[model samples]
Target chain A: MLHHTLKISLVAAACGLAFATTANAEEVTTERHQAEITTVAEGLNFPWGLAFLPNGDALITEKSGTLRRVGTDGVISTPISGVPEVVYKSQGGLLDVALDPNFAENEYVYLSYSEADPAGGPGNSTAVARGKLVGNNLQEVEVIFRGAPKYESGAHFGSRLVFSPEGYLFVTLGDRYSAMDDAQTLDNHHGKVVRIWPDGSVPEDNPFVGQDDALPEIWSYGHRNVQGAAIHPDTGKLWTVEHGPKGGDEINIPEAGANYGWPVATYGVDYDGSIISDKTHVEGTVQPHYYWVPSIATSNMIFYTGSEFPAWQGDLLVGALKGSQVARLDLEGDRVMHEETLFAEAISGRIRDIEQGPDGAIYVITDDRNGQFIRISNADD
Target chain B: MLHHTLKISLVAAACGLAFATTANAEEVTTERHQAEITTVAEGLNFPWGLAFLPNGDALITEKSGTLRRVGTDGVISTPISGVPEVVYKSQGGLLDVALDPNFAENEYVYLSYSEADPAGGPGNSTAVARGKLVGNNLQEVEVIFRGAPKYESGAHFGSRLVFSPEGYLFVTLGDRYSAMDDAQTLDNHHGKVVRIWPDGSVPEDNPFVGQDDALPEIWSYGHRNVQGAAIHPDTGKLWTVEHGPKGGDEINIPEAGANYGWPVATYGVDYDGSIISDKTHVEGTVQPHYYWVPSIATSNMIFYTGSEFPAWQGDLLVGALKGSQVARLDLEGDRVMHEETLFAEAISGRIRDIEQGPDGAIYVITDDRNGQFIRISNADD
Candidate 1:
């Protein structure tokens, strides 16, 4: 274990040094128990999200509104038919995918996408839907949740979905551009984490369920753009990683009815250098569990419980878009102890999503026109 | 004119609000002026640089190592032959193109590219070469200058070339990823601007011409990655715009032998959220004429002296990569008076390069796999 720790640290240090030196330096992976990286699929058009099935195949969502399945042997299926049409604009399209907790019996698959407003407005909203998977196509699909107050912007449709132990689905939403204040308000679904039943019904115990003006689906608010979310294995809590403007990308444990101060209080400034807030702290909002200063353009994340990598157990693995690496955050209770960047040199493009495979290997998806699905495993096995 | 200013301001204000709201909002251009945006050419692969010929043709350099010409009427010619083999990698490859001061007589065209190291090291360096253009082929091509101490990273090879009215060529070099410390040193060329004659010989009047142990070609030092450069119309000074890591993108008047301060004095933190420098200001280092926090990922720049945009005369127009907008900086003497972001709604993808056309219109290239060359003119005209 000590040897593995040293090797991982050296790899992290090498990434920092490598970035400081060459422009075309091939990402060099260090020996952490001789870990092996293998390609699972290639030629993906900006693959955004991923989920696994009991049969060991994986369902991947492309940002261009296609769904694909990758076999255990790395054979990628054609786009699954009956996938809903997506907005398919800048940063919008088919997003996250996950299996229903009772997938063996239900065969239900959940998806998040940028849904064009039915009212023909200038904007689209993040929406969640579920369908029974029959072979390569979806059957009997139904819309589950729709983000409110859709604006014309095609950016920041935070729509990652995670199911709690109690089978409640948590849908993450972004603050639609030009509606940042909506992140602070309960009247809209923008910039919020909403908890609901599998059939799209709001839970009676939801944080804002009794409020007259607030949306009953809102579990928490004040998020900028939560792209990655995962249920903590040990605590069963929902933890998220969000993209900050220039800096201040954050990791948070969003609780019931909590406010995660955004434009009102942030470590980041406006893109034009104007101050967003006078302080990083606000009177009534919760502080982030951890925050990044320069920002890595964080994407999807997962709490690892896999047995293949003993050292990484309980660590939070998050994908980085702009920084082009996987960041592993070691936690001591709720506070982050250390962050070690993995495969910075090995992964060439923006990391879009991360997953722990059924066989205990790690899988990551890159977001690019020529994207790839990469799997990392212990070479000793 | 007041109406135009108000329109521009409203557009700029919209951008600020848009950024505040949606992380993925498509920049919506509100018509401030009767500006007509037309496609000049399409289906280019990440066009990086552009230069106009005397014969009403334009030379374009694709980042993927191809060069082509576009007619005044927007017909794209086949890839030109006889260009040197470039080490096409991330942020490297065929970059800036410029015409010689005596192009009519010499028929000389200058090209900058990431040249693979002849020593077979896993590295490449920025090189500038000149060749005579003869019927879609370069004849008598000879490399003039090669950046020294080549390293293996492919992120920052700042290769913008601008010719001073005095007939000297200015070559911008990036702080070859790991060699940022060399930016403050006189021993190597990384992260420094060098001035040379058309034949690659160092000009005697260069700042370090007689200095001990310093590369005599050095004009300015301590630039991180200068992608945009233009000569001031009146003062004939070399003005540049360079990318900052997170925030701290800057515009500078690079004085001879002056230090601009990279890792030593930066407003940006490391991508991993670590502090890059303890200070944004230090003694003896030059401050930027203008800086953007949270970064716009600035690319190429041009100082407009065109008659078509009368109010924009003497203003600096810059291409933004991340913000996907054209930034217009209004200057009062050396200090920036105001900034207005234009064409944000019209252009999509990363703006790689900008040029002022012979007809006094503005042309820009987008840095996408499916990039396009766009022209902007007064819609009324």
Candidate 2:
């Protein structure tokens, strides 16, 4: 359990450089305290996902379908072997990485990515796979989940994954651009969140388990393109950030079986400045807990529970791929109270993923041909 | 002069019907009062703008380049002759209407619409024209203001017009979709709010009157598509609502010589889920007073000053075309304290404009092939 004052740190100014040369402390004055952005590792290609191991080592996933490890001493490893083949197309490829809660004993790691249909379908969809981590390679890999009704459009393949406190795996899915209207239906996996057991089996208590017309693994429905997700430490509920067309990006705490109106009720218009719908609120559809007008193009999010920044405990930190910044959101209970952008344009490139390392420092990876992994910490430390 | 309380009205359900058939008081429960939606007139073609005359009759602009006058008895006259020829296209055509501050003495009515370039250019732009209302004809009509550098695209032709307390005329402009980048530049009127005298002469104190290379009429710059605007009774400042791509619809208080970040500092992304700008906040740029995520597709707005809704005295009433409703925003000084959606799907089409009549009732015009003129008042009245 983490207990600390929520001192907000806003904005950063970090120039891309090698870890050894940048360790001298490049400080940025934020609202509350002075923070430092130090390069952890660089020279990676389109790093998309990151996770920390018990031994303080970090595993990173590149969008081009490669997994690599970085040692605590900042030594970068070659691509790990036996990773699943991913469809590395627009807004797809290797997406999120997560470790089983019992990873210390099981050594299990999970990866989410865009998977081409095995049955020779026209398009690809998001898939989740897990394997045991053994000496630089993932072995016994098995596909755990696959989003349904693939389309040819290369957009909106939401692939973020998180583990609920109840030990169930939750996978976020997108409404493939060509199939956005179907997001409202229950039979398909488009624009949905699913809960399953560790071995790829549907959880018996899943929201749609007993329903005939609905997919058995569905936990919630009616999402646009959810790329960021996390569990609230205090409430033990899953919170997600999704992209809305044109302007309505939203943060939602999805409840079981709830419908989050996508095309039917949205705050954004169509890209061509035409109205998609005339309702931002519908009776049965869940309203976003918080939403961004002129979306930030949110990619990933986390509720700060690490001890590194005592003031950030319980605050929500979100990564923005468009603005290349991190949004630090202060919350009072379920309501978002305030937001401060950390590292706004301080780093050049799209922010792909963010994680709090075991050392308590925040780690973020930039998505680019030559990507860099960086860590944020209190300058005083 | 209007002096009154702001009784906030939220949500409605008035079915489309003839004026007499819908006049029996169809009541809807709002947050502050039981409001009634009465059809004042129906069967107008895409009514876009509405203004009340001293005789209690209303002047309305139909998008198809027609101006009609509706009497106090709900009798709509034939299209007013001598109106400006307009380019009736997507998000264009006849837009806003306002009366001169001294309409009793001058009978000067102002109309803003999409004007085709006289030079036979490829596209059209927003233009404001003024004329005297004599019976059913607009006598001695003259074009007062025209947005510069037209594009071929038929999107984002903002044409909202309002009169200032000091009798200066203000016209809101758009960033014409193809020319969005020019919004951050000065030399053009794209994405700008301009101030001029009633005779179309530039005000000497106008923000950019003498600024080299900048448009002389530009009072403020850096906007997307401004569709809604009103003057705060207490502060006497002009507040505007502009459509943002995707999600970033904003309400801004335009100040002279100020820059409101459009393409540079927006909260939204491009329609293709790409990053527009990662920075929502930038130095030297004005932030919006309020913004909507997954925008409500705001079309027009007015600061409520009618005696009919006492509880809504200072609230801002905004019309939404995408949501087909009015947003009642409660304000405490400059900040938006709360918001309530009025007439969510209660009406059949897009709400293009809203006004406060001399009788202290709220009036709104719907935009559709078969449009309507409606009044909202306390059911007890």
Candidate 3:
């Protein structure tokens, strides 16, 4: 068990008392800092994902199947047209958007949405598509990748997208509600992270490419519902955060072909207080870097590499939906040293996504019908 | 929409750097203070309610139908023998425990549990019972009140118990999952706070005592699952916290005959993102004293008047199950002035109940199979 010996100092600014520093070695001291919050955009319909374009504008995806562009002057554009039709059901819809790595040359953008099956069944699947940005509309759009064996449930569509330094695109997928058993199988894309080339082709060196009965696009498997994914700038590794059933939210540095346990070896029980699995560890499954008991309902993540906040450089920032705050995790190598909740009292809504602006400011989008885009910067500035 | 202008101060204790007090009048400033945590008891099965006895010992109720005694020296006694048979299903079991107002002479102990229906149907209800505590067993246990129209679902049993200053017992009941519409109706006790005499009789002065259609014991109606309740030490008014559907956990001072809207004027949407009610206010409904937009999953509550924390006198302390911390609300005459999370980094599980001990210290019980009873005191002592 991990024990936290927290000592907080309360000083009255008016008293001007000379305080003594307690020399307790195991004590962790956290200095509170304030940030100036500026509203960037308002009246958004549950903005889900945000990505910075090369031209300093941002593309924001609303869960209600609308994509809008926000200019540098905090002006929101009208909903972009020519996007693919999405199943805008519960926890579905236009999920994540990302700019192509060669966006400056190719003018391409990628999107992940809950796709209604062509057979017109009740089932829906997570599908990734790419398009050329032509003014306010996407042109020449084409589906890149689609999850297999679509299910009928509208919950747990883990559709966050991140680009690796090696230029391959990584897409996180959920266990599709009642299909958690598929997470342990190699035949389906449910509850798996897939890495693919921009044109929807699996790379030759993919981890499960040659394995019998395994999907060639699978990078890592057995995730429950990964909503956050970011590349560690120094390590060039992918760090992801996933929501657990009832309790156990986890953060993991998913390695190639690693089996991150879900129903087989979870730290969480079922939602109805029944045991999903009695074990927290298994022989071949990988343990998480950090797991939160009594889940924070983690959303999106980013690794800070900005100059505006020197003290927070290289720290991992996770947006918490249930806790309704931005969690700043200070890491000592792979282990988390301290965790602090930022903008908790200031932001009243669920934090859906977080991004670093080009000018080194922190931008966050809230999840609500009247959600707002907020920017936070050093108050001293 | 509410806006928060928060400014936090960071002071280096060793060097008293002549801090400038920024005079932002609307800015809320919160100072972090740590407490010394001492484990009072451990290895209890999801301990729910805690009450300090006159002899300085503590009595705790576990949700799995066992009640135990903790001595002043932190030794836990074996389970007391005579607890009524409780339905230990999802979110149901032996719940809140309290002492009679005249415990010295009467030696009566009050308990709230999910009572299985007498007809042996697939249904149960929240029932209150009273008995004399004799050594290790409850003598002559008798049912005092049982909620009508027992429902099969165990999702929301809202069984917190509080005694009014006038010596009437107040019991909270839930909408019982599929019975939310009953919250708006007074014909049943599905979603209401009921005031009654100790011996299963409705108080004659109850709000709906003489009404033909309404239940005579109903004090207030239109509430969801109310998990917390306490009386204001100064005003003697009842205050409660209820879990909302998706967002909008609310704190309300429920007045007699007042409708605290649940399924009608909620700030929350349904679990599938469907609207429960778009209006946050209705003509005859009362607004919440305060609300959490993205809910903290509030549980038990208390109004502190303890001398151990002089600055916190008359404030409301709420145990947050989802946030895994205690929320201290500094109140200025019923309106919340400031809110701060306490023991967030120290307590690692869901806080189920909180109480002020006879010695003025704070005691909390965690909700888990391996739950713990933790006592918090001033670190300076």
Candidate 4:
């Protein structure tokens, strides 16, 4: 691994001639490190989420409500039309659409959206519905998971949907801005990523399985919005990312039933430009593993274990909305050695989804009306 | 002044959306504050220096030795010829170009460049020369000041030319990557902005006017390619910006005979990514008024005293290169309270110059081959 990393870094160094002088023999300051950028692909619209099919083809969801297939060849197929109606407001619309781990056999695709219900909008819940892709059309769409006791507001929907390798699905839902009390309640599913079996049955090993006051499916709580999720390549642990209002955008490895802090301890501030709560750590809520000082408006995360960029293996890949780039985090064991910008200025598009392909290459999709599905690889040249 | 400022802030508050229930209510953190960009102009090549002509028109210089004029009406005229030939390569070429403060009456324009001698490229040097514009052509070009011994390196030409309100022309020179010693030598003019009279004669009031070890025209020493220069509107201070190799892009309010720390105590490192030294406070070299941590590759600067944005009056406007925007710093007296991104992603160009026109409107010129000149006014809904 060391030799492969050095080889790839040498190749990268050759192209980054501008940085030859930047690799000082002395200690590197925050500004002195050099990172290289190469164009991967172009043309994507507010692509909000992605899921890898077993065959390596990826499904991408546009916030404007279109499910498209990004084949391994990097071509964007026509929209597959089983997506539900999305409000698509300030922070609403169709969000976090993922594919089942057994997509090749089961063909079940999962999606989360702000469900428009009669009761205000916690009526706006992170609805996890599954369907089969029947030749560019969804066949037999079923609402697999839904949060209870709707409230108002479409502001934040922690709609990222992911399935653990153990065959259980996790659905992240936001506080819906109606109340923070719902986060502590077990009967309600707000502000948590509820863990359940494929048939929407509560997991027997859930944190609060027999607790009468708590919802049996609640895996974690007090999440602002979980936009990015991926399994750790080596550890197989579930990692997630949440957006803090003004400053915090946290990356966490959550323990089951742990309460992640929101509306309380956050690096972010209120939109009125005031301190959110003068704290970023509450005793009961689990802390994030790592956080960004200035929010990158995070979404879509994956850990690199592909063979294409051997140096990048085991690193984390995160999509940033405000950063308008893909962040490649280099880790030396557990400590973050340094962070590099991978598809930053080169892509010039919001990367909403990233998935390692079966062929050891990587695919990314853009989010927005004029987005595209792009593939990233080593330059053939 | 406090009451007036409060009044304007109150008005701004009226238009600003209040903090939602979740807003932190404290001022936004410095990192999360983003600048709003307004494209004042576009279409030009490496537009480096800007001088608001007496009639409110702007004289913008392209690094290709073209002196283009941006009229008050927002029209870009054909090249105002008669600029001297420059060795246009990595860091040389038609560098800092500015006009006399009395340009309306004198028709005199000043230009600086690293011209190629017969031996090789005379390293970056400030050769203050004047040219008179007669219709489409410049007539009777004369050399005002020239470096004694030419350098052959094609870099570090601090060419910004600005005259104080009292008519002392301040010229910035660069230390062609050799070190601070070159700038310290009396015979060499590599890293000094020589201050002189209109006729290029040494001013008796200069700090080293009669010193045997000092150059008569030396105003300040040890600047590393000062790129931006603007006289403080109220204080009449000569402020300069010099590019630091890797990190230190300094904003210096220069004083006579001061050593402004180059090769010593730099906020930046060598271009090759090596740490040069780690000292920010040296006894002799003056400190930067302000410095950028993660450099934006800064360019020209200005102070806004316009009527349209009364609250923004007397604020410093620094052009950001790598950030591709302009920053407006809010000041509490001389202290920077906070900064607002005045021109961010909106003006899709590198800001080369910023000048407050005679009409009290602000104007900017973009850099690069296809740069444009833009005029800024109150945004009309």
The digit string of per-residue lDDT tens for model 1 on A1-381 reads: 112222221112221222111112122333223466666667678999999999889899999999988776556777898888899999999999999999999999999999998888777899999999999989999998888877889888997999999999999889875688889888998889899999999899998888889999999999999999999987899998888877678888999999999868876766776766746668899877777766789999988888887767887889999767888765545545345677876667899999999989889889998777878877553
State the displacement of the C-alpha of residue B221, model 4, in Å, after optimal TM-score superposition: 1.1
Error of 3 at B174 (Å): 55
Over the stretch B3-111, how does candidate 4's per-residue lDDT look in tens digits?
1111111111211322111111111112423212233344567877777766666777778777766654445667777778777777777766677788778888888
Candidate 3 runs further than 4 Å off: A1-32, B1-381
CAPRI class assigned to model 1: incorrect
Clashing pairs in 3: none
Candidate 1, residues B1-381, lDDT tens digits: the string is 212221221112221221111111122322223565666666677899899998868899998898988776556677888888999988999999999988899999999999998888997889998899998999999999999877788878997999999988999889986778888999888989999998999988888998898998899998999999999998999998898877778788899989999879876666675777857668889867677766789999999888877667887899999867988765535545345678776667799999999899888888988777777777543
Q: Model 1 RMSD to the real structure?
A: 19.7
lDDT to native, each model: 0.81, 0.82, 0.81, 0.68
Q: Please, what are the lDDT tens digits per residue for candidate 2 over residues A151-244?
A: 6777888878899898999898899966988889999999998888888999878888888889998889889999889999998999998988
Q: Which tens-of-lDDT digit does each residue in A1-381 have in candidate 4?
A: 001111121212222222111111111112322222222222445777776776676777777777776654445666788777666766676777777777778887788876766455335556777788777888789877777755567666777777788888877777766565566666787667778887788878999899878888888887777777877767777888877777677777778978778777676776677876666557887656677756788877888897776656787888887756777765535444335555554455677777777766666666656665555664321
A134-186 in candidate 3: lDDT tens per residue? 89999999999999977898988898999999999999999997899889998
Could you tell me the C-alpha RMSD of candidate 3 in Å?
26.7
Residue A120 displacement (Å), model 2: 2.7
Residue B286, candidate 3: how far off, in angstroms?
A: 57
Better of 2 and 3 by TM-score: 2
DockQ of 2: 0.02
* Model 2 reproduced share of reference interface contacts: 0.00
Give the per-residue Cα lDDT of candidate 4 at A339: 51
